[model samples]
Target chain A: MSALDSVPTAVSRPELRAGEMLAEGGEGRVYELVGRPGTLYKAYRRPAQLAPLEALIAWEARLAEAQPELAARVRAATAWPQAVVTQPGAAGGTAAGLLLPRAPRRFAVRHRDGTSRLATLSYLTADPGQRAAAYGLALPAPVSADRIGIVYALARVLEAFQRAAPPVGHGDLSTRNILWSLERGPEVFLLDCDSCERYSPDGEALDSGHRRRAMTPNWDDPATPAGANPTLASDRYSLGLIFLRVVGAAHFPLQRRQRDSELLSIDFAIPPAARRTRSLLDGAVVWSVCARSLSTRDPARRPAAAEWVSALEEVLDGLGAMSAARAVWAAQGGGTPAPSPTRSAEQAADVRVRPVAMSGAGRRWERVRPPGPGLPALPQSTRPAPPAAAPTRTAAPAPLPAPPSIVELARTGLGRGGELWLGAHRATLASLSRAGRRRRATRQVIGCLVLDFALLAVIFYMCAMVAGVLLGI
Target chain B: MVNVEERYAVFPFYLCLDASASMAGTPMESVNRQLPLLRAAVGEDPAVAEVIRFGVVTFDDVAHTTLPLSDLSLVEAVPTVVAAGRTSYAAAFDHLRQTIEDDYHASRGKGDRWYRPAVIFVSDGRPTDDRERWQSAHSRLTDTGWKRHPNILSFGFGDADPAVLAHVSECKPHRAFIAAEGAEPATVVPELLAGLIQSIVSSSASVYSGEAQLVPPEVPSMTPIPVDELD
Candidate 1:
C-alpha cells in the first residue's frame, strides 16, 4: 500500500462476478474484489480516460519515492487510483476501471437509526443542531477550534496534492467526494480520485481526455471561468470555500453573491451561522487567508496551499494556548471546574463497544417489515438482531407496596412538624368523660393559637426594626 | 459584510402523472407506492438532495399539483395520486406552465437559483382535449420566450400512442419512451418507476459534473420512440 508501483496492472480482462455489486451510481458500479480483502473494483459504464488514470498512478509512485511522508498522507487520505483494469480488446486493451482499497470502516459513522453511513462533507455543511436531530450524530460545534481543526486537516491533504511532481487538482471537491471523521482526530478521505485533474511537470495537460473534470454545483469556484479546466488557483478557491462552509456550518455562497451583485461596493459576507458559534477565526491570520482566497475575482490573488497551511497552523497554536489558559484558570478556581480533555477510563472502554440501542421489540418490528423491496440491504453486521434471538418478557410483575395505615400517616405528619407541643398527648376518649375531653381539646387549641400569634408578632417586629435601620442609614 | 442575491442552486423535477381511468389499477398503485421511495432515495443521498427539488402533478380531465416543488429532504411524504376521468394533455400542460412560474419566483425569493426545470410526463392514453388546445398549452409551457420553460421527458404505456408521446417530448431523442408491445402494465409500472429513481439520482449527480442534464430513464421493458430527421 506504500507504493503505487507495486500494484498489479492487469492487461487481460479481469473476471468480474455478478451479485458482488456493493454500490452503483450514474458514473460506474463498485464491486467487491474476489479474495482481495479491503479492496474493491470500480467498473465504468463507458471507457474512462486511461491516460489521466495512468498519470495519476505514476504521480503517486513518484511521490512515494521522493516524498514518503507526504505520500503516506495522500495514500491514507485518498482512494487514489492504484491500477488500471483493462478489458481485452484490439491491439492492447481498453481501460474499464480501477482497483483501489475500499473506504476504511472508520470513515463510516454509526448513526442513531442503527446504521453506519459515510461521514461525508454534507454532514459538515449543515447547522449542527439540525444535522444532529436529522442524522443522529453530533458534529463539532460550528466555528469552534475542533471545526477549524477539520479545515486544517483538509488543507494539509490538499497541500500534499499541490506538492506532487505535477500538482493535481481535485476538480470536484464537493460534499459527496470528501468524507470527514472525528474518530481518529480531524481527518478527511477524498473519493472519486479517478476524476482528479492532473498535469505533467513539463506543462502538458495530462487530464485532457477526462470528461469528469467539472466543478460541483454549489462547491464550484465562481472565479474559475466557464469551460476552463481546474487548476491550482481553482483548487485554492475551492479550499477556501470549503473552509467557509465547513467552519460556518452553512452553505455560504459569497463567491456567487459577489458575482451576481450589480453594486460595486458590496462587502464580503460571512455565514450567519458563524455568529452563533465562538469563532476561533476572529482577528486571526487564517481568516485573512480564507477571505483573500474567496474574495478575489482573479484566481492568482488567492492564497497558496503553503500559505493556508501556515495560517491554519497558527490558528491551531492559538487554540492550544487558549485551551491551556482555560485549564489554568479552572485549576486556580477563577472559573468553574473544566472537564478532562481525555475521556475517563470507563468512557474509553465504552467507545470500543458499540451496542445496539434499539429495544428487542423495535428490532423485531424492523425485521418483520423491510424498508422497501428494491432498496439495498444493510450490511449483515449492521442489521438488527432476529426475533428469536431477542429477549422476551415472561415473568409476572412484582406485587405493589402495601398502602400506609391512617395512624402511620398521622405519625409521619406529626413527626415532620417536630410535634414538640403535642408530644405524649395521644388519647382514645374512652379513658375520660366526654365533657373533660372537650375541655382538654379547647385548651390545646387556645395554646396553639397563642403560639402562632406570638411568632407572627416577632416577625413583624423584626421587619419594622430592619426598615427603621435602613432609613437611618 | 451583508450578502445580497446570495442563492444556492436547486434543480427542480416535476413528475406529471396521467391519472386517467386507464391508469386506475396497477399503474396508479405503483405510482403511489413508489413515489415516496423517490423521496427517500433522494433524502438518503444528501449530495443529490441538496440541489434537487421534486414535485408531483396528476392529470385526468383536469390537473392538480399534489405536491409543490420542494427540497425532498424537507419533504416528509409524497402525496398519493388517484385515477379517474379521461386524460387531458391541455390541462396538464397549462397547469405545469403556471406552477413552474410560481415555483421559480417563490424559490428565487427564498435565495434558491434554479437550473432549467425538468418535467417527467407519464401517461397511459392519448390527450382527450382538442389537438389545437393541447398543442397551444404545450407551446406555452415550453415556449422559448418563457424564462422558466421546462425540459420535458415523456413516458407512455397501455393504449398510449408513441406519436403523441414523441410530440409531447418535442421529438427529442431519448426524451420519449413507450412500453414494448407485449409488456404488461403491472411489470412496466414498477420497472418504469425503478428506472426513474435511477435516472433522477444520476441527473442530480450530473450537476456535480458541471452540466446539469435531463437523463432519460432506462426502463427494461420500454423503447425510445424515434424522431425522424429532416433532410
Candidate 2:
C-alpha cells in the first residue's frame, strides 16, 4: 500500500501560479506562490491514519484565541481552510490549506561580503577548517575582564526566569533553540515553543507539572519517558547541556555510544576542562543545576525551578559585581599591573602595628602629637599628685648552672688499658698503696696456689721414692 | 523565613530530531512513540511538569516546525508519526536557527529568562541535499554571540551514517551515534527513548543547584553488525 493510502482521500491539487514547490512536509506541502508579490502556502493533506485536519484547524483557531500571546509568536496563517480541487476520479472533497508567512530569504547569517553566509551543518561536516572554526566559536572564552560581564549577563537571565510566578521550563533548551540577530548589535531569541510547560502556581517549588512523555535525545533527560510528567528539573537538564555546548564541549556527560539502554546507568560528569573555561560563579551555578537535576537515580531529589533560579541569582549577583569591578579596572588601564614589593611591605608593617601603652606607673611616655601652628594650652590639673607606688614586680630567680659539656666528659678518657686493663691497673695501684694489707691478701691467695702445687710435686716425689724402695734393692 | 511556595523552578529542553528518509522505517515510529512516553514521564514528576517546557522540529526534505516552541501542557494530544521523505539537513538547520531565534524573543518578552535549550536530532540517513546549508546554519546557531547553543545530538538507525549524524550533532566522539540495527521499532524505540530521557534527567539534576559535580551515564555494550551483515 502507498504511504498515503490510509489517508481518507488523495490531497487535492491546488491551482499553480507558476512558482516552484520549495518543500514538502508530512502534514502539508509548502509552495512558493508566483507573482510580483510572492508568498508561501502550506497545503494540508487529509490523511487516513491520523486525525482529521479539521480538528487541528479548529484546535489551532481556539489556541490562537485563548493564547493570543503565543499565537503572535508563530507565523499565523492569514487565511485558513482554503478549498482545493480533488484529484481526478477521486471523491469530490475539498483539501484544506493555509497561507503562512514566508521564511527569511537569507537563512544563514551573512558575512560582510554577503557572499559567504555562516556555515551550516553541511559545510562543517564537509570541511575540517569549517569544523575547527565552529569549535573555536563554540568554546567559551578564557577567564578575563570581558568574560566576567558575559557571565553576569547569563546569570541575570537565569535569575529572571527562576523568579517567574508559575515557574517556566524551556523543556528542550539547546543552542539550536537560541537565535542571534546581528542587527545594530547582537540580540538573542529562543524558538521551538511546542514543548514549554508552566508549573502550577500552587505546586511545589521547581515542580514540573509535565505528565506527557516528551523529549528530544541528547538535549533532554534520558530518564524521562514518553507521556512522563514535566518538571523544572528536566528543563535544567537541557540548560546544562546548552551550557556545555556553548563551552565547546558538545557531548553530553555520557558518550553518545553510551546513551543506549544504559542511559540510567550513566552518571553525568563535567569535564575538568569545562570547569576551567567557566567562571567560578558560572561554574558553580551550572554545576548546582546539573548536579541537582541529575543527582537522584530517582527524579524526586532534583531542585525545583524556583530553587534553581534563586541559587543561580545569587551567583549571578556576585558575578555581576565582579564584572563591574573588572570593567572599572580595565577602564583604568589596570589589566596587568606590576607587583609592588615596597607597597606590600609598607602594608604588612601597618598591619603589624603594636598597641600603645597607657600605664601611668611605667616610664614617662611622650606622645608625638602632630605639629600645628596653634596648640591649645594644657588645662591645669586640679587633683594633687599621689606618691609614687612601690614597684609591684617580683624578682626573677637566679639562673641554674649549665650541664657539663660533652667535651668535658670526653676529656676524662679511659686509662692506659681498656675496661679490663683499667680494672687490673686499679687493683695493682690499690695493693701498692696498702702494701702490707694487700700483701697479706696476696699471701693468702699465693699460699693456697703454692701449697697446692708443692703438694702435687711431693706426691709425685713420694710415688717415685716408693717405686725405688719397692724395686730395692 | 523562606516561603516554600515562592521557590519555583523550570526545566528547559530542545529536541533536535532527524527526519531523513531512512528514519521512515521503525526508527521514526519508535521515536514518535517514545516522544509521548518521554512527555508522560516528565508529567509524572511534579517538578518536571511545573517547570519544564518542550519544543519539537523534524527535518527531512526540509526542516519543518512540526510544533513551535510551546509549553508541554498545550500539547494535550500526541502527534502521529508518518515516514516517507528524503533528508535535507540544510533545511533542518535553517528551521532550527529560525525557531530558536523566535522562541528566545518570545521568552524574553514574557519576562521569562530561558535556560539554554537542548536539541536531540535523530536521523537514519546522510544529508542527501546540500551540505553547505546545514553547516552554515549550524555554525551560526552555535557561534559565540549565541552562547546558548542547543546541545545537538544525532542518532542513526539501520543503514544510517554515523559520520553524517555525528557531524550534525554538536556532541563528540562525533562518532557517538545510536542505531536500531535490525531491531523493530517496538523494541528499539523504548530503549532509545529511555536512554534520552535518562540523560536529560541526570544532567539537569546535576546542575540544578549550581555547578554540582556531574556523574556520567553508563551505556550498554552493543556490537553493531556491519551494514553488509544486515542482509
Q: Which stretches of candidate 2 lie over 4 Å from their true place?
A: A1-473, B1-9, B180-186, B212-231
The best candidate in terms of DockQ: 1
Q: Measured with DockQ on alpha carbons, how good is candidate 1?
A: 0.07
Interface RMSD of each candidate, angstroms, one decimal: 20.9, 37.8
TM-score of chain B of 2: 0.78
For candidate 2, what is the total of clashing residue pairs?
192
Segments in model 1 whose C-alpha atoms lie over 4 Å from true places = A1-19, A23-28, A43-68, A81-97, A109-115, A126-141, A164-172, A194-229, A252-283, A294-302, A316-473, B1-5, B88-109, B126-152, B161-182, B202-231
| Top-lDDT candidate index | 1
lDDT of 2 by residue, A1-473 (tens): 42223333223444545267755544556677676243455555652211333332333344445543333322221122222324344443333454444533322454322333322212111112222232222312322222233322232233333444444455554433443322212122343332344445543423233224245444556546545654556665544344333322122333132224333222222233333333242324434444445442455445444343334334334445344433322322122221211111111110111112122221121211221211211111011111121122112111232365787666544332245444644565566577468766575556556755875898899999999999994
lDDT by residue (B1-231, candidate 1, tens digit) is 322223347789999888889898888888878887887788656667777888877787778777777666555556667788888887788778777877887777766788999999999898887666677677767778777889899998888989888889898888988998877888898888888888888888776554678888889899888886211
* Candidate 2 chain B weakest lDDT stretch, 10 residues: B1-10
Judge the docking of candidate 2 as incorrect, acceptable, medium or high: incorrect
Instruction: Score candidate 1 by TM-score against the native.
Output: 0.64
Separate DockQ for every predicted complex: 0.07, 0.01
- Would you estimate the TM-scores of all the predictions? 0.64, 0.31
Question: Model 1 over residues A95-129: C-alpha lDDT tens digits?
Answer: 78888778888787775547677878887775566
